[model samples]
Target: MTVRTRLLDPAVARAMSAVSAAAKKGLGDPALAELVVIRASQLNHCAFCLDMHLGIARGHGVDERRLDLLAAWEEAEEVFDERERAALALTEAVTVLTDGFVPDDVYDRAAAHFDATRLAHLIGLIVAINNWNRVMVGRRIPPGGYTP
Candidate 1:
């Protein structure tokens, strides 16, 4: 089915395209990026991103248990480790940017987990997903159409 709204507007699409190289740099595992994408999309209720990321995550060997419990990763002791946790925290902070600018504590925690360059890329990932979420949610992209 055709999406009700375009998934990528010109500006957002350009921004995403610009970040492609940086996102591919040696910041973190591609698998971890997929994990963060899935978790953030799940939290933001963005069907387009959730669909894309879940498939990527699975291709990278993410198990069903972890995927199923992603929304509750904090409460569940899944396979996600400290670095993943830090990425998740950053995702949550950026995705919900209105809750306030990403707090220093959040940035510091993520910085601790990742090097300067990796942390920058990590933040970029968060920003990218959050932008995607806003577009999808704002346009009210319908769900149940995304197949894993």
Candidate 2:
């Protein structure tokens, strides 16, 4: 499918960029943030986002094996730490909202690993990526075009 729009209006793009900046500043770990983005993209099945985030994650030094195993993070705990697992769980919850609500257990687990501010940032990142995924998927934005 062809792209519906080459870019969002400048104002809207700026707002989205601000949200991304906030996420980058708020989330201390670049690798963790990329993981959250990658997982959300995978769940949303957005090829553009998946391509972009996978490249970003690799730039942040996320291991190839970990990225490969992220789709099955539950069964590949050996590759993920507690914090990564918690973030992935949160990503899944946020991405698949129709499957069920974000469970209290998942939120609590992520909270246990992150402070209130960081948790808010993590949530923001999840929400932001989902928003991007919807836009890209809806517009059928082609993949492999993003540089970062």
Candidate 3:
């Protein structure tokens, strides 16, 4: 729990709350949102976000197996299906923000699973989590103190 700049102070918290409220309305499943957040946090090496999202995901009924295999999701035979995989891929692409935006093939794969509304929501979630990751990591937030 090394001291780091908190993203949500009394003033900034309001703005963050607005973003969270919108993400909640957009994201259909709390579990999926948590999963994407955790994965993106992991990619960004943001320990604060990883701990928070892991706790949130488990609270929403995500089990140990799926959590364990998340880093190596493609090689594992876990509970995630094609839709989840596609969303996960989207999460990666969005967080990385490299390779020239989200590729058409990735969008097509995700589109096959989610409707237009859900897709939009999913993208919003990805962007929000990635933004959090960038801020926390950039601020040099330390790990191992979080409960989850």
Candidate 4:
């Protein structure tokens, strides 16, 4: 793969992964955490992340239909629950950044569903995935060959 940087420093990469792990652990719901990361990866067009996380999501027992309909989750109300929708909406708001900041409505909606700690972890997860997305996309990393 073509790289913009020689490579991320090994320590930095490990630190980022650690942050992601912490966020996922705090968030508590393995499947929901996967969904949030997958949504962010989708928006960021991080094929490497998508390939890796999709497999992880399936392992967590997330339904194929949910994965298939994630891009259209807002419209697929029947597939995604309110909590999942809230998380997905927050993921989009944070990932796209076209609106400058995550809108209050989206944040509030997510807050309504998740407690303070979980909300923080959810945000942390989004940030971590977004960072990972940028690194992989910036480096033009190809999907597959990802290790768990």
Report every candidate's CA lDDT: 0.77, 0.89, 0.81, 0.94
In model 2, which regions exceed 4 Å deviation? Answer: none
How many residue pairs clash in all the candidates, one count each?
Answer: 0, 0, 0, 0
TM-score of candidate 4 relative to the true fold: 0.96
Index of the highest-TM-score prediction: 4
Q: Which model, 2 or 4, shows the larger lDDT? A: 4
Where's the lowest-lDDT run of ten residues in candidate 4? Answer: 1-10
Better-scoring candidate (lDDT), 2 or 3: 2
lDDT of 2 by residue, 1-148 (tens): 7888777678877898789779867988999998889888888889988898899889989999999998999999799999999999998998897656999999999999999999999999998888888888887888987864
Per-residue lDDT tens digits for candidate 4, residues 12-124, read: 89999999999999999999999999999999999989999999999999999999999999999999999999999999999998879999999999999999999999999
- Is candidate 1 or 4 superior in TM-score? 4
Q: What is the lDDT of candidate 2?
A: 0.89
lDDT of 3 by residue, 1-148 (tens): 4556755566665675577658857877888888788889889998888888788889999998899889887777457888889999888887886886888888899999989988988888888877777777877887556663
Q: Which parts of model 1 have CA positions greater than 4 angstroms off? A: 1-4, 7-14, 24-26, 143-148
Q: Using lDDT, give the best candidate's number.
A: 4
- TM-score, each model? 0.81, 0.94, 0.87, 0.96
Instruction: Work out candidate 1's RMSD over C-alphas.
Output: 3.1
If ranked by lDDT, best first, what sequence of candidates would result? 4, 2, 3, 1
